[model samples]
Target chain A: DQQVKQNSPSLSVQEGRISILNCDYTNSMFDYFLWYKKYPAEGPTFLISISSIKDKNEDGRFTVFLNKSAKHLSLHIVPSQPGDSAVYFCAALVSGNTPLVFGKGTRLSVIA
Target chain B: EAGVAQSPRYKIIEKRQSVAFWCNPISGHATLYWYQQILGQGPKLLIQFQNNGVVDDSQLPKDRFSAERLKGVDSTLKIQPAKLEDSAVYLCASSDGKDSFQETQYFGPGTRLLVL
Candidate 1:
């Protein structure tokens, strides 16, 4: 079963605009959420993360908002840049020493 | 600092053949993990080791897959008598095992395997 899901397969936005990526999860045990950005032939790099106790976390131009009641979360990038174009994977971390459960990923393209 | 290192970026083998992939995690990292990512799908954890000791292997297919981390460092993952369905990118990741909530995993480029 897919514990985490990213409904949108792809997204496109113009440079200097805002980009939003969404994710959902079915497992309530997950208390940590993370977003990773991946490029072709390279490993995924960490972007931003949020804990269940917080509704939102911000890092520079990236912000993650969590809505526990809806079992959903989103990553928002304001003034997106071409360098931001990549496949983004949303992952959920279960409490304790456990591996992350990842979603299918969403590909975002930022036009220059 | 050097990132995680993986050997033989790509490998091709026929079904029923054995294949082994190697990984060297970032220096001083106490936790190592192996994952399998199929095409068009997200990565799935295969096994995890904390300082040369297994922390989790519940998702590993022990019947055909085996992994080991020696001396609390570098690791190796092997698949014996592989099946066509075993084709996927094997990813190695590492993190400091100090705190679960603050830990951030760093991944390697991955080793892509193709089984005929």
Candidate 2:
């Protein structure tokens, strides 16, 4: 059974627009969540993260929001640039100390 | 501040052959993890090491897959009599091992394996 799920497989957005990627989880014990961005032929790199204690966390153009009660989280990127075109994986862990469980990933393409 | 390092970027072998992959984690990092990522799927945990000790290997197929990190600084994964299903990208990652829940893991470029 997949503990985490990314319903959307791919999304496209024009430059200077906002792109949102959503994720849902079935495990309620997961308290820490993270987003990783991966380029072709490279490993996934850390993007942003949010804990269940907080509803939101932001860094530069990237923002992550968590709705613990609903077991959902979303990553928001404002003024999306072409460089943001890649696969995004949503991951979560239980008790803040377990190995991450990752979703299939969402491919986002930002057009110029 | 060096990231994780993996060797044999690409490997191809016929069924029943043996293969091995190596990994070197970041300097001073105490935690190491190995993952297998099949095409069109997310990476899955294969094994986890904490300073030369095996912390988790539940997902590993011990009958054909085995891993060791004797020195705690580096690790190697070996598969004997490989099968076609063993084809996948093997990724090695590491973290500082200080934070309980907020630590960030750095991943290596990964070694792509193809079993013919």
Candidate 3:
């Protein structure tokens, strides 16, 4: 079963515009959520993360909002750049020692 | 600091053949993990190791897959009599393993395997 899901397969946004990516999970036990960005022929790179305790976390132009009641989360990139075009994977951690469960990923394309 | 290092960025082999992939985690990182990512899908954890000891291997297909981490530094994952379905990108990741609350995993470029 897919514990995590990203409904959108792909997205396109104009450069300098806001880009929003969404994710959902079926497991309520997950306490931490993370977002990773990946380029072609490379591994995923960490982007932003949010703890269950907090509803939102922000790092520079990136912000992650978590809604516990909905078991959903989202990543927002403001003023998106061309470099921001990549596959974004949403991952969750149930506990400190457990492995991360990842979503199918959303491919974002930024056009200038 | 350098990120995780994986060998043989790409490998192609036929069915029933054996192949091995290696990884070198970042300096002083105690926790290591291996993942398999199929096309159009997210990565799935195959195994996790904490300082040369296994922490989790529930997702690993032990019948054809095996992994080992020596001296808590480097690790190797091997597949014997590989099948066509085994084709995927093998990713290696590492974390500090000290603080779970703030733990961040670093991943390598990954080794892509194609079984014909």
* TM-score: model 3 vs. ground truth: 0.98
Winner on lDDT between 1 and 3 is 3
Clashing pairs in 1: none
DockQ of 2: 0.74
**Per-residue lDDT tens digits of candidate 2, residues B7-116?**
98999999999999999999999899999999988899999998999988999999999999999999999999899999999999998888866777789999999999
User: Rounded to one decimal, what is candidate 1's iRMSD?
Assistant: 1.3
Model 2, range A71-106, lDDT digits (tens) per residue?
999999998999999999999987545688899999
C-alpha RMSD between model 3 and the true structure: 0.8
For each candidate in turn, the interface RMSD (Å) is 1.3, 1.3, 1.3
What TM-score does chain A of each model score against the native chain A?
Answer: 0.98, 0.98, 0.98
Q: Which is superior by TM-score, 1 or 3?
A: 3
Of the two candidates 1 and 2, the one with more favorable lDDT, higher being better, is 1
Once fitted onto the true fold, the runs of candidate 3 whose alpha carbons sit more than 4 angstroms away are none
DockQ scores of all models, one per candidate: 0.75, 0.74, 0.76
Q: For residue B68, what is the lDDT in candidate 2?
A: 97
Worst 10 residues of 3 chain B by lDDT: B97-106
